[model samples]
Target: MIYDGDEVEQELCVDLYWSFRSPYSYLALHHVRALAKAYALRWNVKVVYPLAIRTPDFFKRMDHMWRPYLLIDTQRIAESLGMPFRRPVPDPIVQDPRTLLISLEQPHIHRLTRLGAEAMLRGRALELVDAVGTMLWDGSVDGWNQGDHLARAVAAAGLDLQDMETAIARDPQARDRLIETNEAELRAAGHWGVPTFVFRGEPFFGQDRVELLLWRLRQHGLQARSN
Candidate 1:
């Protein structure tokens, strides 16, 4: 029973972010729903393209070191959460700047993000976001390998994929703008990583940091002293 400060007095917005290509983002999506429910908070999913795009050489270098660390860390986290996770086949998005081959630039990604924003506008963003996030995190479906998996994920959220696609494709400028807007918002929130949570302008990066955000929320609500 947390009370909202002014305005609607019913919900608090937790800016939830993730990169479509990031395995850690996949892992973090696992616990987001439960955390939101526990805190009585509504999550606004902010999907951003990974930094790998901006730094191609950095990605190539990190591919040797950071990728292994990502795999090990994500597996450990997923095991702890008892969530099923598999290395995404084809890796969802490749770190290529020339083509933007990753799902981050896919029509599906744009459609989904737009739909998410629409949901937020309509006040049903929380539930829609939870459902979509869960499906995206459920690695049993092989998001990268399965062709129909994304459409299924979108449908599960009570959204019409065909209609969304039609709408998204019809407005290329708007899609680009949306992507740019999310990217700007991510940067403004601090770090550009997925699973980043922003509360009252404070950014907490990673699923592991979720507890920290919860603590901050509690402190804000209860007026607890910081030690």
Candidate 2:
């Protein structure tokens, strides 16, 4: 499916802090894209590394039940939204299977996250993530990072993977710094989570808060585009 860019007037703007490794972020894409289509709004897509990468000790500090509950809850949310849900095969962030301890040498997530930042720079952040997120989380394909899967997803988003890669390689650190800035901005917005949407300085965290976000947007005079 082709994505619609912000073709209408920029009546409102939203900052979305998304993570490639977050299943909730993947679930949130459906609503995010829908909101973009239904309203004349500008989206400032800020893709950041998941908590697993940003804070290596985050999961370790969590209760033993955190992972199980996350899986269960994300699956339920995906089903309720009629979207396919699966933990990415070879999960984006490399980790020990038995210990569930994160690895420092994370090749997959670093590259993916950097590409996300590059996409945002190219003004196709939502399109790139929407296509890539579906490919990674939809349960339709495995080895999402291998073959031409990622390249095709990038193409679907109207971008070329090689171009994006070259752009990132030119200044990889700069891309990473942008992600760090997004993390800081996210915290400043009063939340620290993937799929956090900030509108007019108010932070709405989680996929479940989409309605509330919409309600807030509506209160601020969000106007729908006439088809």
Candidate 3:
């Protein structure tokens, strides 16, 4: 994982907007990492707050079929991809089940978003999120937000979680502003959802559009790196 003195060539830049609480984002993360590594592309990430918390009005008026269909579709997609799938324990957003109204308390998610920004600063956000989000979404770990789970995941991604937490604590306002900026960029990119990939101002939204992105990348002369 160490980079030598030789400078790496960069070509396309993918502005990836994702959410920690999104199952689709969980599923698409590894692919994004692979896409970046497989070709000469600058894989930039913009982590944002989930729609449930970001837009309360829309969350309240969302189509009734949205949640149920999302659950069903995620399960189906997980099965097709041979990935472990399960509903998160104490879901990321603590909401009233009846009204689906998001709660004001979001200790876990706020920490995640803040640390996600830290990871990005360290140039490892995609890898860190891919590792930790899968644990939460795939049911591999319980109480993902508790104990040393997150720390271990960060370490595995070649970062110190304690250091990241420390840095974030040092400037809460800066991290908050970065997240706000990311949300604004996501909206400006013509998409407000997780897993939206924007390449040179063109937006490809959704986990299923990865192939489409690849096609466009190929059109721009993307090629596999010589081993």
The all-Cα superposition gives candidate 2 an RMSD in Å to the true structure of 4.9
Looking at model 1, which ten-residue stretch has the lowest summed lDDT?
A: 95-104
Give residue 114's lDDT in candidate 2 (0 to 100).
93
In candidate 3, position 15 carries an lDDT of 87
By TM-score, how accurate is candidate 3? 0.92
Evaluated with TM-score, which candidate comes out highest? 2
**Residues 143-225, model 1: lDDT tens digits:** 53357766676667777656666765676567556567877887897977676888878899887887787777775563322
The worst-scoring run of ten residues by lDDT in candidate 2 lies at 1-10
Question: Where does candidate 3 have its weakest 10-residue lDDT segment?
Answer: 1-10
Model 3 scores a C-alpha lDDT of 0.82
Clashing residue pairs in all predictions, respectively, total 3, 0, 0
Query: What is the Cα root-mean-square deviation between model 1 and the actual structure?
Result: 5.5
Give per-residue lDDT, candidate 1, residue 45.
72
TM-score, every prediction:
0.76, 0.94, 0.92
